[model samples]
Each structure stands twice: as C-alpha cells, then as structure tokens.
Target: MPINILMPALSPTMEKGNLAKWLKKEGDKVKSGDVIAEIETDKATMEVEAADEGTLAKIIVPEGTQDVPVNDVIAVLAADGEDVKAAGAGAGKAEAPKPPASSFETPAARAPQDEGSAGGKTEAPTKPTTNPAPRPEEGAPAPVSKGEATHNGARVFASPLARRMAKDAGIDIARVTGTGPHGRVIARDVEQAKSGGGLRSPAAAPAAGPAIAPAMSDQQIRALYPEGSYEVVPHDGMRRTIAQRLTQSTQTIPHFYLTIDCNLDRLLAAREDINAAAPKDKDGKPAYKLSVNDFIIKAMAIALQRVPDANVSWTEGGMLKHKHSDIGVAVAMPGGLITPIIRSAETASLSSISAQMKDFAARARARKLKPEEYQGGTTAVSNLGMFGIKDFTAVINPPHATILAVGTGEQRPIVKDGKIEIATMMSVTLSCDHRAVDGALGAELIGAFKTLIENPVMMMV
Candidate 1:
C-alpha cells in the first residue's frame, strides 16, 4: 500500500500551516525519522520528519504552499517493493489516520454513574460496536440517520469510542444521529450530543458570534481616499497575529491603570557600581552589564511576591494564582514586538536576567524563538523609555493579570523635608485586570514595586 504523508499538527491550536521548504526531493530514498520538510506555523518554523521508510513517490502539495489543512496529504511514499510510478499516480487517495482517542473522551467520561436501585428494574448498559466503519470522503454529504431499524428492532450503529462516550454522558445512543459514512455514529457526534442529547446534527448547531467586528475590506476603505494618496502595504502573518491578539486583549479585558513616580538615583548609582565591578570575559569584554529594565523586572517580580494576591490570572472557571513570577519583557522587533519571558525572575540575579534578556531580544528579532519561549507568563513589562516616551499605559495581555509600563528617568526637582532636591525620577504605569486585581490590591502591588525600585539595595535581599 502507498503511504500518505499528511501535514502534521505542530501545535495543539494549529489548524493549518505553511509548507515552508522541502529538505528531500522526489525519487529520494527516505527512511523513518528522516527530516523531510519544514513547516511554518503561526508562531514558529519547525522541521517535519517522515514516519515511513519508502521512496519519495510524489509531492502533491509543493513547498511554499500556504494554509494546508491538517490531515491533508502533502506527499506520498512508495512502500518497499511497491512500484513508485503507480504510487505517484494514486497520490492523495489514502485514508486519513484516526484522531487520538483522548479527543473523543468528554468531561462526562469521569462523571459518577447512576446504578440501578433495588427496584428490580436494572437497565443494561449500552455496549459499543466493535466493527470499524469506513469514513466519509471529503465533501461527502452526511448521512440522514445514525442507525437503521431492522425487522426485529431499531439498532444503534456507532463506533465503540462513540458509544462509550455516549454511555459515560448518560445519553441514549439510539437517539443520537450519526453523520459518519453509511449512517454510522462517531465520537464527535456523541461529544456534541452531551449538551443536548441528539437534538440536532453538528451542522445544525448554532454558530458562535464573532468576538470582534469585521474590518472593512481594503477596496472599500481605499475608495474613501484619493488615488495614489497612500500606499497599501499588506500585513504579514506576524503583524496580523499581533493586531488580532492586541485587539482582543483591549476589547475583552477590563483594564484599570495605576501610575507611580519613583526616584531612580539609587538604582542608577547601583547599576554603575555593579557594571564597573563586573567580571571580564575571554574577549576582554564585561561579563554582564545590567540595565535599568533589569532592575524593573526584578522589582516587579519581588513586588508580586510581596502582594501575592495581585499575581493571578482570571479564567471563567476560577482565578489562577502563580507561585513564581515569570515576567515577560517586551522586545521590539522589525515588524512588531514580542514578549520573551524571564522564568522565575524573583530568584535570578540581575546579571543573569540581563544576559538572558539580551539573548532573547536577539533571537526574537531573527524570529528564531520557539513557541514556549514567548507563550505564557505571570506578568509582563513594556518599557517605552528607550523610545523617549515619558508615561503610557499598556494593554493587559491575556492570562497575565498585570503589565508594567516603564518610562524614562530624568532629573527632576522634589520637595524633601520642606526643602528642594534634584533626583532622577522615573514614571511607571501598571495596567491591571480588574477582575483579578482589585483597586486596593493593585495600589499595594505598585507601592511595593516603587519601594524596591527607589531603594535598589532592597532587591538584593
């Protein structure tokens, strides 16, 4: 049999991906585990490997193809001793592999079952059908009914997995309609039936409303402006993802802002001393030079620890309290920005944080970071100080209850003990998720941060 090479799912949420490049060409003898191609997901580019040993018969979906759906055959393999030309001609005809068993299991799989009482009316548990049914071809219409009624009685024709799920959900499998090939009930049907038992087909289920309003088409918007007045630059994948995520964040999250001004004289003085006494490397360069942002990251991490209640994430189920502060620092790249996290920032030394951040920023601009490197964080820091921005509020990234916006430090006069004094003061704004951090709690967290930032020595403790 000719083996089909389906597009692999690089990430859980990935439905489609770009076939970036092909490492192997047609007619190449490929073995199991051979690197065959590169796939570009929305977040990262990953290498895909071959799972079967065979001669590369054909490439159905060539490299550079965009948005190839998962489970779609991208290539074909001529099995050993099989005719290569025959396999190439029959490419894309192989059946897709079954989905993982866990995807079929619903929440009700672990629910308590109601056993019959001593009323002597024990109902037999429904058993799943052992024979596997053929799957429907792509674009094939779904069957009208799930099962057929024989002369003896009505019989439920469902896969073993689907029947098990229906039984776990306490739903009558006979009542659930099937959309699989030849009117067979499948796992998806049973899973969808849990909410309202067999009331409607999956196709008939109500569609969810869009989270954000649709944008105007390019042609529609361009008609408003004069011709040649402006150039239309199309948005790349990175920019599109950034715009969508940021828009979702601002619209969905109820953000509350709190600003505080801190004296940075001590922090600057400490940074200079620390840099001057830093160790040298083999190249005669300083081993590490800490930046003010590093201090801010440390201060924020410690502050979250001090005011633990403020370090949380809001979910529909409940609040997620983090044990350590994984602080994501916004690094500006060519097209946009990415937040690479410093895991357990509260425990890392200033030098270590600075070094890690330097590496992250370099890799981030090159778009070489893995998804996990920039995905989750307890909180985030967005510093526009380098751009000469004084004070600004940042949008709250989802799953992070707060984001600290740092401003540039400049010499300013302050009244101290009824006298005037000049000090280096920096302004900061903390954006909090209203649901996770209340007003008083946010204030306390920012106050703790200001205390540590103004008194740089306290961070060492």
Candidate 2:
C-alpha cells in the first residue's frame, strides 16, 4: 500500500499551515522519526518528522505552499520493495481512509452553542444519552446533513438523522443544540429542539438585520487608488493568522489597561553590578549578562506570585488559576512579533532567564522556534524601550490574563519628601482581560511589580 503523508497540526488551534520547505525530496528513503519537512505555523516554523519508513514517491504539495489544510496529503511514500513510480501514479487515484472519529472533527463540528434561547433561557443543553444509534464502520463516510447555516462563516455539523428530523419538524438544524461527540447534532437533539427547547441559534446570526456588513473586496479597495500607485504585497500564512487572531481577541476579550511609573535607578545599578561579577566562558565571554528586561520578567513573576488571583486565564467553564508564572517575552521579527515564554520564571534565576531569552530571541528571528516555545503562557511582557517607545498599552493575548508593556528608562525630575529630585523612571502599562483580572486586582499586581523593580534588593529575597 502507498502511504500518504498529511500535513500535521502544529498547534491545537492550527487549522492550516505553510509548507515552508522539504528536507527530503522524491526518491529519498526516510526512516521513522527522521525530519522530512519544515512547517510554518503562525508562531513558528517547526520540523515535521516522518512516521513511516519508506521511499518518498511523490511531493503533492511543493515547498512555499501556504494555507495547506491540516490532514491534507502533501506527499506519498512507497512501502519497502514497492515500485516508487507506481506509488506516485496512484497518489491521486486512491482516496486515503478517514481517520478515527475522535480525531476527525472539523472546526464547525466543535463550535459552542449559540447564546439566547427562544424563551430567554441561557442554560446549555444536557448531554445526550449514551445509548446512541449504532455508529457506521470505523472507516465509513459520515452521513450527510442538509440546510446550510453558518457559525463564524463555517458550516454547521449535524448527523444526517438530525437533519431529517429537523426538516420534518420545520426546525432549523443550525438552531438545534448538539450534545453528541464534539457537539455534533444527532436525531434526538433535533427531536428535542422541535419542542422549543434544547436548541441554540447561531451566535453570529442576528434575528433582525445582518450582524455586520461584509468587508470590501480587494478589487474594490484597489479601485479607489490610482493604478500602479501602490504595489500589492501578498499575505503570508503568519500574517493572515495574526490578523485573524488579533481581530478575534480585540472583539471578544474585554480589555482594561493600567499604567504605572517605576524608578529603575536601583534596577539599573543592580544589573550593572551583577553583569560585572559574571563568570567568563571558554570563549572569554561572560556566562551571563542580565538586561533590564530580565529584572522586569523576574519582577512580574514575583508580582504574580504575590497577587495569585491575577495570574489566571478566562474560559467559558471557569477561571484557570495557574500555579507558576510562565512569562512570555515579545520579540520582534521580520514580518511580525512572537512571544517566546520562559516557563516557571518565578523559579528560575535571573541569569537563567537572561540566557533563555537570548536563545529564544535569536531563534525567533530565524523562525526556528518550536510550538511549545511560544504557544501558551500565564502572562507576557513586551518591552519597546529599545525602540524609544514610551507609555503604550499592549493588546491582551488570549489565555493570558495580563501583559505588561515596558517603556524606555530615562532621567526625569521627581518630587521626593516635598523636595525636587531627579531619578531614572520607566513607564509600564498592564493590559488585562477584564473578565479575568478586575481593576483593583490588576492595580495590585502592577504595584507589586513596581515595588520589586524599584527595590531590586527585594527581588533577590
């Protein structure tokens, strides 16, 4: 049998990726665990390892191909002793078998039920009974459903039996609540929906006028400007994903920002002293040289520890309180920015944090980070001090309750004990997800950070 190689999902939320490059070419023999290609996700570019030992018979998707859907076949491999040419010829002819039901869900199939019921009820539908109708064969095609309705522009998923019941009852299948596996609407769900219960209307669809006007097409926008006045730069997969995610975050997450000014004189002095005392390596380079950002990271970590309530992520189920501070530091790259995390920042030493960040920043610029290096974090810190940006709020990244934006440190006059004084001050803004961190709690968190940063000795304690 000819083995098909599908594009792997680099992250939980990754639906598609760019086939950045292929390490193995056609006719190359690959062993299990051998890296065969590099896949570019929104956050990073990762190497994909082959799972089967075989000869690469054909490359269905070439390098630099963007937006390749997950599980779509990108290559074909011939088994041992099999003819490579014959396997390549059969690639497009034979369809690959469907994966297990647990792993074969589409985005629409896993969407949550719509808010606002017919009778002002807001409770979710109860789970359906376990005595489901006998499922088809493991590899059998799923039965088709009818009535096209969209949630977030994706088609709704329902069992064929549910569609039939919904059609007969004059109920919209999209409005019927799905309680089956991965929220798939089954026959019983549709039957229950007919009784004016157990159904959820599409969240994106409004009962009155359209929820939102459609965006102008590219051609329409381009027509407004003179021809040859501007050059069109095609969007890469990363840019598209970033735009979609940021838009979704701003729209869905309620953000509240708090700014604080901290005196960085002590921190700067401490950093200089610490760097001077650092040990040298075999190359005659210092083993560790800490930056102000390192102190900022440590301060934020300790602050989260002091104000544990602020270190949380908001979810539909409940607040996720993290025990450790996984601090993500935003690093700028060619196309966009990425936040590579230093896990357990509270536990790691300042020198360790500095070294780790140096490595992450270097790899980040090269687009060589792994998914785990940049994916999830309890909180984030974005420093634009180097670029001379002062006092700016950052958008709250999802799954992170707060992100601290640090500005450049400069000398400024200050009132001390009713007298005038000059001190090095840095302005910092904390952008919090209002759902997760309340205003008072966010203030307390930033206050803790300010205290640790100003009194660098306290951070050592």
Candidate 3:
C-alpha cells in the first residue's frame, strides 16, 4: 500500500496551516521520525516528523501551500521493495477529503488545489476547534484511551455512529471522554462511556444564556462605505485564526480586569545597575541587558506562586492548577501577534529570562518558533511599555487564565506624608478569567506582583 503522508496538527488551536516547505523531495528515501517537512501554523513554523519509513514516492501538495485542512494527504510513500512509480501514479489519482463549506475562510481555500498550487491540501489542528481531530495518518484504528484533550471550544470529534449512539442515550456528546486519535471519540469509546465513567456533569457544558448576536451583515456594512474607497485585503491564515480565537475567547471565557500602578523607581535603578555590571563579550556588547519587562515576567511568575489560586484554568469539569509557571510573552509580528512562552520562568534568573525573550522575539518575528514555544501556557504578559501606551487590558488566551498588560513607565506626582512628590510609575492591568479567578484572588495575585515589582530586590530571592 502507498502510505499517505497527512498534514499533522501541530497544536490544539491550529485548524489550517501553510505547507511552508518540503524538506525531502519526491523519490528520496525516508526514515521513521525524519523531519520531512516544515508546516507553518498560525503562530509558528514547525518541522514535522515522519511517523513511518518509506521512499517519498509522491508530493501531492507543494511548498507554500496555505489553508490545508487537517488529515489531508500531502504526499505518499512506497513500501519497502515496492515500485515507486506505481505508488506515485496511484497516489496522484486519489482525491483528498473535501473540507466543509464552513471551513473555507476565502474563495481561494474553497477552490481545489492543483499540483504545484500555492494553496495547501491539508491543514493542522487548533480551536477556534470546530470538530474532532482526524485519525492518524498511519491508518490504524487506535483503541486506547489516552485522555485526549479537547481545546478552544472545538466541537466533539465523534464518528457518525458514535454521535447517533450518544443521541440515543440522551447523553451530551461533549461530556464524553474521547479516546481515539488526538482524543477523538470513537464508537467503542462512546459505548464504554455509557457506563458513566466518561460522562461529565451538565455544568461542564457551556453556560446557558443569551448567545452573542452576529455583527451587521457584510452587505449592510459595505453599503455604508463607498465601494472603491476601500480595497479588500484578504486575511491571511494568521489574521483569520486570530479573529476566530479572539471571538472564542471573549464568548467562552468571562473576563474581568484589575489594574494597579507600581512605583518603578527601584526597578529602574536595579535594571541600570544590572546592565552596567553585565559582563561584556569580545564585541564589547553586554552579555545580558535586562528590561523592565524582564522584571515584570519574574514578578508575575512569583506572584502566581504566591497566589496560586489565581493561576488556574476553568473547565466545566474542574479547575486545572498548574505546578510550574509557563509565562507567555506577546510579541507582535507582521499579520498578527504570537505569544512565545518561557517555561518554568519562576525558577529562571532575570538575565536568563531576558536572553530567552530576545531569542523568542527574533524567532517569533520570522515565524520560526516551534509550536511548543507558543502553544499553551498558564499565564501571559503583554508589555506595550516600549510603544509608550499607558495601560490596556489584554485578551485572555485560554489555557491561560490570566494575562498581565504592562504600560510605559513615566514620571508622575504622588502624595507622600500629605505632600506631593515626583515618582516614576508604571500602570498594569491584569485580565482574569472570572470563572477561574475571583475578584479577591485576582487582587491578591496583582497585589503580589506589585510588591515584587516595586521592591525589585524581592525578585532576586
């Protein structure tokens, strides 16, 4: 059999992906776990590994192809001692699964891809999730219950029979634990779920309330503007994904914001002294230079530790309290922004965080970051200090219950002992998922952050 090389889902939030480049050309020998291609997800470019070994018999999807849906075959492989030409010929004639009309974000994606076409044939996985994950490309019907997780409010991926069974059982399919590929609920899993081990409380489902109304119709909105005055710049994959994810976030997660002003006198001085003492390289450049944002990252990480209750993700089932602080730092790029995370940030030194951030920023701008670097984090930090924005609330990217928005530091007058005095202050807004973190808990978290930030030396300990 000619083995199909399907587009793998790199993250839980990625639905479509760009087939950035084919690292291995057709007719090349392939080995298991070989990094055969690079797929560009919404936020990062990932090198995909081959799960099986064979000769690369055909390339069904070419490089730079965009918006390929998940599980669409991009290439085929010839088995050991099999005829390569026969494999290629057979695979080329095979039609990939057509994506649903709802999946098409543009006319370009809706159109079928010709060989060498820039449009992708298969996309990756993510939310903004409309359906259950496609089966693995290996063609195996996996039977294990691997605790497959669903994310970003994606619709449960269940077989038609499974859906029918659940419907007959009067069970909410969303509450059943999927045990198939990427946690897709299969027929057998559904059968086992009937015993109640797989069922979740009705509370686990989305809260019943008035739904968010749709915006004005496109035709209506266009009527208000002169036709030629506006040029239609089609949204690329990144922009579309951003719109969807943001919509999902706001609609699914109830957000509440808490703002506080921190005195930056000590932090500014500490930063200056740290940079001055930094060892210089042969190029005479400082080995490490700390930013106020660096201190903020450290403070936020420590704050999460101090007020652990605030660091949690809300699922209808329960709260997920993470042990380590994975802090995602938002970096703006061409089409959209990517939040690259610093894992275990609470334990890392200030200089380490600065260096990691610099590397993440460089890679992020190029869209060269791996999916793991940007996918899931417990919390996030968005600093517009360099942009000179005073303060703003950031959208809470789920999986992350809190996001701290940092503003520029400026000189402001404050009263001390009933007298006015000049002080350097920076304002920060913490956006919390109210379902997970209550007002008091959020206050405590931000309060701890203020203490560490105002007294910079506390972060050293």
Clashes of each: 1, 0, 11
lDDT for each candidate structure? 0.75, 0.77, 0.76
What are the per-residue Cα lDDT tens digits for candidate 3 across 137-222? 66453333334333235445554445667789887677776543324454545666676565656556522322334444457556
221-286 in candidate 2: lDDT tens per residue? 668877788776655546644654455467667899999999988899899999999999899899
In model 2, which runs have C-alpha deviations exceeding 4 angstroms? 93-214, 218-223
TM-score of 2: 0.76
Measured against the true structure, the TM-scores of the candidates, in listed sequence, are 0.73, 0.76, 0.77
RMSD of 2: 11.4
Query: Candidate order by lDDT, highest to lowest?
Result: 2, 3, 1
Best model per TM-score: 3
Off by over 4 Å in 1: 79-81, 93-211
Candidate with better TM-score, 1 vs 2:
2
Instruction: Please provide, for model 1 over 156-221, each residue's C-alpha lDDT reduced to its tens digit, 9 standing for 90 to 100.
Output: 455545566777888776666554322345565675577563433423423221244445555656
- After the best TM-score superposition of candidate 3, give how far the Cα of residue 11 lies from its true spot, in angstroms: 2.3
Report the candidate with higher TM-score, 2 versus 3: 3
Residue 415 lDDT (model 3): 96
